[model samples]
Target: MHRILVVDDEEAIRKNIERLLSLEGYEVATAPNGQHGLVIARSMLPDIIITDINMPGMDGFAMLDAIRHHPELDRAIVIMLTAADERDSMRRGMRLGADDYLTKPFRREELLDAINSQLKKLARFNREKDNAVAKATALTEEKTREHFREQFAGSSFPASQFSGYTPDGSSGFGVSLPPESSSTQTLQATVMFADIRNFTTMAERLSAAELAALLGRYFELACRPVVAFGGTHLKMLGDGLLALFEEDAQPQEDALSHAQRALAASVGIQDAVGSFKQWVQEQYGQRGLPSFSVGIGLHSGEVTLSRLGGMDSPEVTALGDSVNIASRLQAAGKELGWLVVASIDTAQLAGECLRHGRQELVSLRGREKPVAACEVLGISAVPSLQQTHPPFKYDPASLQAAAVQNSEMTARAAKEALKESLWSLQSGSFQSMQQSFRGYQIIRKLGEGGMSDVYLAFSAAQKSEVVLKVLRTSLSNDAEMLRRFIQEYAVLANLTHHHVSRIYDQGFTDDYAYIAMEYLSGGTLKEEIRGRGTPGNSFTGSPAQVHGRVIDLLRQITSALNAIHKLGLVYRDLKPDNLMFRSEGGELVLVDFGIVKNVGEHTVGLMPERLVSTEHGQVIGTPYYVSPEQATGQEVTHRSDFYSLGVMLYEMLTGSRPYKGDSLNELLARHLHAEIPRLPPEHAIFQMLLDSLMAKQAIDRPADAMGIWRGLDILANKTGSLPKARID
Candidate 1:
C-alpha cells in the first residue's frame, strides 16, 4: 500500500481522515503541527501528504519547503487543505508545487475523487519510470559529445541535512549553510501589506485562542485575493499578510492588479469579520467582537529571492526596506482614513492597469525623501473603450462650469422668465442660493425665513430627504458676516451632537449660496402650539399637558445649546423658530445659524471701506430673546444665550412674548430693565427656571445650558411620562 500522511491541529479531523483513507487500503500517519509532520514524512517517506494550511507552529507552507528538499519525499504529492474560499490560495499552492488543493466544507465524494486522482497519477508515473530512464540515457549519450552538455552540472538538496530543527521552538539548530553560488534572478514582483488599523485594542478584546482564530481567518481571506492575481503570500505579520509576485506570471498580472487585490482583501476582511461578530452577537450578546477597520499599502520593486539562515532551519524571505515602508504606509492610511495607498513606483509599473487618484507626498520615518503615493481607485484597468467613466469625473471643473452656466441662465431667466423670484426688496440679494440641482427632487417648500428660504429636497446621493436652505443675496457681500458664517459652519460640521441639525453641504454661487442640512419632517414648535392651543382663553392649560410639553422643549433646546457651548460657539438667537420637531419620534432638532457667534466677546474686524461704522447698535437678536446686557450694547457670553432660552420657553408656554414693543428703541428699553412676570404656582418648574433665565445680571442665569436642561428633565419626569403628548 502507498503511504500517505495527514497533518491537522484538530484530532477529530485527523482521525476521521486516517480511518477513511485506511479503509481504501493506504497506510496513513497523522501529526498535529509542522514540526511533527516533517519528522513523520521524513521517516516514513509517505507517498502523499495532506495538511491544513493554518496551524500553531510551522504552518503548511513551511512544511512544504522541508519536504521539497527530501530526496525520497521530493516526488511525494502534497495536497493543501483550507477552509478559505479564495481562489488565489489555490494558485499559490500550485506555485509551491502542491499536487492539489481542497477547500473545507467539502463533500465526502469530492475527497474520495481527489485521493483517487492523485493515486492514479502516481501509478501512471511509476509505470513510465523505466521507459523514461532508458530514453533519457540514450539522449544523454548523444548529448555527451556536445561541449554545452558535457560542461552542465547539477546540484542536490537533501532532507537529511535539515533533520536537526523542529517547527516548535523546543530545540535550536546549531549549523548554518553556505550561500548558493547561483546567478541572481530578476522578477517583476508586487509586494502588499494588509494591516489592522486598531489591532492592539482588538487583541485586548479577544482571548489568545480567539485572536489566533481571527488571524487565521484574516490570513485566509487575504491570501486568496493575492494568489488570484498571481501573487504568493510570503508570511504573516501579526495582523497583516505579506504577498509577493513572480516573473513567470501572465503579462496581465501587474502591480496594479495586486494592489487592487490587497484593497479588496482589506474590505473583504471587514465584511467577513463583521459577519463573524454578528454571529457571535446572535449566540452570545455581550461576548460579540468589536468592529474592525483595515488599511492596505502596495509597492513594486526588485526583490532578491533567497534561502536565509541555517540549512536545517532556513526561512523563505524577501528582504528590503520597500517591504517595511509598504507596511508602515498601510498603518499611515489609518490616520488618513484611506483604504489603500499605492507608491509612485507601483503606479508607474501598473500603468494603465492601475485605477488611482492624484499623487500625494507622504511623510515616512527614517527616510529623507517623502514617498509619492496615490489612492488606489479600484482593481480593473481603464479600458481603452470607454469615452468617459463616472468615477473619473472632474468634480471641481464640473462645479465651476456649472456655476458659470447657472449664472448666465439666472440672468437670462430673471429678465425673460414670468415666475416671480423668491427674493424681494426685503429679502436682499440671493447670496447663498442654489438654482439647479440636477438630482435633488424638491418635495416642497418647508418654510421661508428672513434671511433664507428652506425646502425639503429628496437627495438621490444620500437616498434620504435633506433641507436645502437657499440664502438671501443681500448678505452675500457682507464679508464680515460671510467670514463668521464660514467659521461657525465649519465648527458645526465637525461637531456631531444628537440634538443639533447636521450640516451636510455648503458652497457659494454667483448670485446665490446654499447650505444643505438634515431635513426634519415634523412641523416647527410654533406651528404645533397654534394647532394644539390651550383650553379657551388659555395658552397654558392643564398643568400636566402644558407643563410636560414646555419642559420637554426646554430640555431639548438646552441640550443643543450645551453642545454648541462646548465647541466655543454661542447661538445668539435661541427661540422656537430655530427648533424643528421630528414627527417620527417627537425628537427636537436645533437648526438655523444665521446669527451664531464665538463664545467670548471680540471687536469686529471691519473691511477698508466699512471702517466708518465703528459704533455697534443693539446687536441683532430677537427682541424678546435678547438679554438685558445685549439690549444695552454690552459684551455678551454663553450665559447671555441662556437668558434668551428662558424667554423662548416662556413664549412657548404662553403663546406670546414675555415682553414686546413696536419699535427697536422701545424694545431695547423694555428688555434692559423690565421685570419678567412670575408664572402662577401651577406652572411648576417654569417659574424657578424663568427666575434664573430672566435674571437682570448675566451671571445670575444658570451656569450653562446643562443646568437648565437638567432642571427641565426633573420637571419632565415629574409630569408622569406624558405619553402621546407631543412637545411640538
Candidate 2:
C-alpha cells in the first residue's frame, strides 16, 4: 500500500481525510499542524504528503519548504490541499515543489485519482520500479475508475459516447448514433443543457495537467446524473453537458415519462453542486474558494439526431432550434442566478413532484421575445433509481432524531431517506402562493426576522427589483404599532436624502403588514466587515489607508445622521447592520428606520423593532453599541448617535466591542460605566475621536452630527490623499 501523510490545522478535516485514504487501502498518518507534519514527513518519509496551507504553527508552505531542503522527503509526491479560492497559495506550493493540488471539498474519487495519476507518472519514468509493480498500479487504477463509474453512473460510462464533436459547436442535442450509422432522424425529447460557470476563465489560469484533472472530475460528476436517469450524455460541448431523455430513455419497467426523467436528472446534477458546496465548506470553511455551480436549462421539444463522417472519423450529433434554445436557457441561468432554468413545458410535463420555484419570462439573445421558464429550487421526489448518485447529502441531525425512532440502511441509506422525508415535508408547500398581493410578485424569501419575513419581489408597474418586508399577521392586533408604522412611513416618505433608503410603497394584506423598498446589492456594512474578519475589526491594508478609510466612513455616517437629526429624532438603533451600501462604490445608506418598528416596550431582542423601554417607560436601544444615555434610560439626543458611532468606530479599529457583560443588565452597566479603550499604537491618532464620543456623560460628546463631521474633516485634512485604507 502507498503511504500518505495528512496535515491540517483542523482536527475534523485531518481525520476525515485520514479515514477516506485508509479506506482506499493507503497507509495514512495524520498531523494536527505543520510542525508535527514536518517531523513525521522526515521520520516516515511518506510516499504522498497532503498538507493544508493555513495552520496554527509553522503552516503547510513552511513544512513543504523544509521537506524540499531534506533529500529523503524530496521524492514524496506532494499534494497540497488548499481552499478552492486559494490560488496564490497553490502557486506558492507548486513553486515549493508540490506535485499536485486538490481543492477542499474534493470527492474521494478525485483524491484517489490524483494519487493514481502521480503514481502512474512515477511508474512510467522511474527505472528502478519493478515492471510487476508498475503493471499492478495501472491495473488497480483502471479497476478503481470502473468502480467509480458503477458508483455514480449506476452502470458503465460508454467510452465511445462522444467520439468526435461537430464543427458548428452544435450537434442538435442527442446521444449520437453509432459510427457506421448515417441515418438522420427527428423525434420529440426532453433536453437538459448544463455548463459550468466561469470555466473558461478557470481554464485560462490552469496548466494543461491541472485543467485536465479539474475537467475530468467535473465531467464525471456531471455525466453521472444523466446516465443514471437513463438519459444519453452528449459530451461534445466542452465544459458543458448536453443530455437527451427521449421516448426510449427510461426502462420499460420504470413508469417515468421522458420529461420527468429529464427533470429528475437535472435535479441530480443540481444536488451534486449542493453536495460539492458542503464538501468545500467542510474542508475550507469560510476561507474556501468560490463554490462551483452549474446553470442547467431543460426543455422538451422536437430535435434532430444527425451523424457525420465515414466509419473512420465518424461523429454522432444533433441539430434543431430546440437544442439551440435549450443551450440558450442554460447560459441564461448564470445571469439570472438560477441553478436550473427549465421551460414551462418541461415543468408542466414533469409529474407529481412539486415545481418548487418562481416563474419567469427568460429573455434570449437571438430570440425576439422571451421564453417562459421556471427557476428550479429543488425537487421533492428522488430519482426513479431510488437515490441520488452522491448519497452523502443526508441531514445527520434529522437522521439521528429519526434513528431514535428506529431504522437502518446500507450503513447510510436509512439516514438519507429520513432526511429526504423531512425535505419532502417542507417542499410540499414550496410553490409560489400566487396570491394577488397588489402588483408585487414574490420570487423567494431573502430573510426572516422575529416579526417579519422579507421576500425578493418584482413590481410589474415599476419594472424594478423591490423587497417586500411583510410583517406577521399577529402584528395586526397591535393597532398602536401598526399606526406608528404608517405614521413613520408618512414622515420618512418626504426625507429624500440620497443616504436614506427609499420606501416605494406600504400596505396591509390579510396575512401581514408590508413595505416595498429598493433592493441594494452591496448588502450591509456588517456583512462587509464580517467577511473580512471577526466582529468587524479585521480589515487588511496599510495603516494610513485603514485610518483614512475609517475616517471616510465616519464622515458618511455623520452625514446621514445629519439628515435624520434634522428632524429632531435620535436613531436609537445605529449600528453596522443598519448602515447599508448602495453598491460596490461603498456609499452608505441608513436603513430599517427604528422609529417605524415598535416591539413590546419591555422585550430585549436583536430585531430592529426591539427598541426597549423599562416598566418605568424609560426607553433604551440595542445592547453592545447602545449609547451611555440609551443604556441608562436618560434623555437621548443627536449626541447619543455620536456615542453609538463611537462604539461602531471602536469595533472597527479593534477586533472587538469595547464593552462586555454576562447578561443584559450587566452589559448595559458596562456601556454606562466602561472607560473608552485606547486605539492600537499605529491608530492612536484617533484616540481623541473615541475619548469624547464615548464619554460616560452624554454632555461630553460632540454636540451634533455636524460637530462629528467637522472632527472627521480635520482628520482627513491632516492625512493627505484621504479615503483610502486597509491593514497590511
Candidate 3:
C-alpha cells in the first residue's frame, strides 16, 4: 500500500484527509502542522505528503524545502492545500518543489484525482528507473568497460587512432608505458571551455565553506549536459571545466557531428547552471546570495593527445593550438558579454543548430592573425538556459546606413523636441549628434531628469534599440552623485520582474556614466492619466469600465512594489512619472529607482534640509505624494510606498489631489497636519481603502504591498470591478 502523510493545522481537516486516504486502502499518517509533519516524514518515509500552506511554526513551503534537501525523503510526492485567494502562497509552495496543490474547500473527487495523478507519475518514474538499471545490468563486465572506453575515447580521439596504446595502471586516464616508451596520437575533436561568470567576486562575498558547497553543487549540475551529449568530462579548472567530443568511426559520427554534440552539451550545461541559479534565488532570495551566470565557448580542430609530465606523475592530456583557441574563445565570450561564443569553424560545422550573432575578429594572445568568431545566440530549437538580454543580431550594412542618418538627424531633432516639452531638458550641455556613447548611436533624446538625460539609441552590441540614461557630465566629478547613479544600476541589475525595466549594460566613459536598458515607448502612467483624465470627469468609459481600469493598474502597481520590497529595498518615490508602460506588452514597468532605500540603513539626506521636517532630519521625496513619515524625516519602510501609491490612486479616482498647497513647504505641512478629504459616499469602499493606505502612522496602514493588493482585490470584487483575469 502507498503510505501518505496528511499535515494541517486544523484537526478536522487533517482527520478528514487521513480518513479519506485510509478508506482508499492507503496507510495514512497525520501531523498537526509542518513542524510535526517533517518529523513524521523523516521517520515514516511516506510515498506522498499532503500539507496545508499556512501553519503556526514551519509553513508548507519550508517543510517542502526540508524534504527536498533530505537524502531519502526527496522522492516523496508532495501536494499543498491553499485557499483560492492565496495565489502568492501557492506560487511559493510550487517553487519550493510541491508537486501539486488543492484549493481549500476542494471536492472529494478533486482531492482524490490529485492524489491518483501523483501516484501514476510516481509509478512511471519508478518503472523508468528500474528499466535503466536492468539495461545497465545486461552488459557484461568486459563490455561495460569497453562501453566506458568508447564514451571517453569518443570524447577525445577514436579508439582506432589510439591503437597499440596501453593504460599506465595509475587508474582512470593515467598514462603508463614501458620505461622507455612515449607515444602520442593526433585526432580531430571539439574542445569546449565553460566557466562561471564573476566567480572571483562571488568567492570574495561568500565564506569558504559556503563557496565550496556552492561549487560542489555547480560542478554536479554542470557535468550532466556533457555526459548526456556523449562528451567526456576532462577536468575542472577551479570555477571552470573543460570537455571534449571526438569523431567516432564505429558510430559513423564525423567531426561535424562532434561539433554539434559539443555545442548541444554547452547549451545543456548553460541550462543546468541556469536552473541551479534559479533554485538558489528561490531558496535564499536574491539579495544575500550572489548572482550567478556561466560563459561557454566551443572550437573544433585537430589536437595531439599525449602522455606528459614527470615519471611518477605522467598524465594524458590534450596539447595543441585547438585547445588554446577554445580557451581564448571562452574569454572572448566573457569580454563580449555573451553566454556562449564559438569559432567560425564550429559555427559552420554545427550548421543549423547554431544561431549566432555578428561575426567578429578576435585577437588571441599568441596568435598573429585575428580569428573570426560568432557569438552563439542559442541552438535553433533549444531555448536559452540563462535569462538575459536577447542576443543582438548584427547587420553591418543596415547599421552603417542607420549610423550615418542618425548622426545627421539626432541633434537638430532633439533640440526641437525638447523646446516643445521643458521636461526633456536637463541642466547640462547636451550631447552632439556626432558623439557616440558606449558604442550606441544616439537616435534622439527621450527625456531628461534632474540627474540624468535619457536618449533613444541603437546598441550595436545588442543589435536593437535601447534607452540609454547618462548621468550629467557636470556631476561626474561629484562623488555622491556618482554613487547614487551607480546604485540605481546595481539595484536594477539584480531585479528580474516583468513590471520592472530590464537593464542590459552599464559603464562609464571619460565624459559620462550610462546605463543601457529596455526601451519602452508606450509613455508613462502620468501621460496615460493625463490622456484619460480623472474618473467621472473627462473619462469616456462607463463607471464599471473606469473602475476596472483602476483596479488593473492598482493590481500591477502593488504587485511590482511587492516584488521590489521582497528584495529588501523600499521604493521611496512612487509617483506616476516613474511608472512606465511597455508598448509591446502594455505592462506597467517600475522605473527610476534613483531614490530607493535599503530597508534598515539610516542615511542623512543629500538634498537641502529645508525640504521638510523629519525626526531623521532627512526629507527626500516628491512634495505632493510624500508620505507623512517622509515629510517628518522618520524611518521609512514598505508602508511608506503604499501612502504614495494612495495619493496617486486618489488623483486617479477624482479630478484633483486630496490636499492642495501653494508651495513645497505648504505641501509638506498639509501632508503632516491636514485631514484627508472625504470621498463621495458612492465610492465609500474605495474611500475607506484610500484612508487606510494614507494613514498618518505607518503601523495604521496596510502591512505590506501584498496586504494592499489583497485589500484592493477584495474591494474590487465587492464593487463589481474585479478583473476576470489576474494582471500579473
Q: What is the C-alpha lDDT of each candidate?
A: 0.57, 0.63, 0.66
State the TM-score for model 3. Answer: 0.40
The 10-residue segment with the lowest total lDDT in model 2: 402-411
Residue 664 error for model 3, in Å?
A: 1.4
Best by the lDDT measure: 3
lDDT of 3 at 693: 88
> Which scores greater on lDDT, model 2 or model 3?
3
Ranked by TM-score, the better of candidates 2 and 3 is 3
TM-score of each: 0.38, 0.38, 0.40
**Worst 10-residue stretch by lDDT in candidate 3?**
160-169
Residues 1-728 of candidate 2: C-alpha lDDT, one tens digit per residue: 45689999888778767755653446689998889988887666677888888888889899989988875566578888888888898889999899999998887568877887776444222212222222322233223223322333322224233332322343222233644454566878888888766443233223334444455555556656676676763442445567777765334554567787788778888878777667545543322123567788888888876654544433455667777778888866654456788888788777567474656576675676789987886666554465333211222342232222111111122223223433443355222335456689888779754234678998986798787877543212233344334444554565677677888886544335678888877788777666654333426677776677688778778777777666555677788988888786467778876353232232112222323222432444557787876666666667888888988988777757888864456677788676778788988888998998998888898887777777787888887536432211
List, residue by residue over 1-728, the lDDT tens digit for candidate 3.
46799999998788767755654446799998888999988767778999988888998888999999985577689999988899998788888888998987887678878987776555444333323322222222223223334433423222211111111111122112223335556778898988666453343334445555566667667766675565652444435567677766554313237787788888888788868987667644522333588888788999676655543223445667887888777866543456788999988888887887756576665566778888887776543423211222222342232222222222222223323322222233233434577589999988665466789999998899999998743222233455566667767777788889999987654245689999998888887777664444323376666677777788888888887787667888899889888882388889988778776433222221111122364666776788998877788889999999989888777656778764345667899888877876645558878988889888999987777778877878776875543434
Clash tally, candidates in order: 13, 12, 3
Clashing pairs in 3: 168-176, 614-632, 614-633
107-186: candidate 1 lDDT, tens digit per residue: 55577678767764553343233223223223321221121112211112221111111111111111112234232234
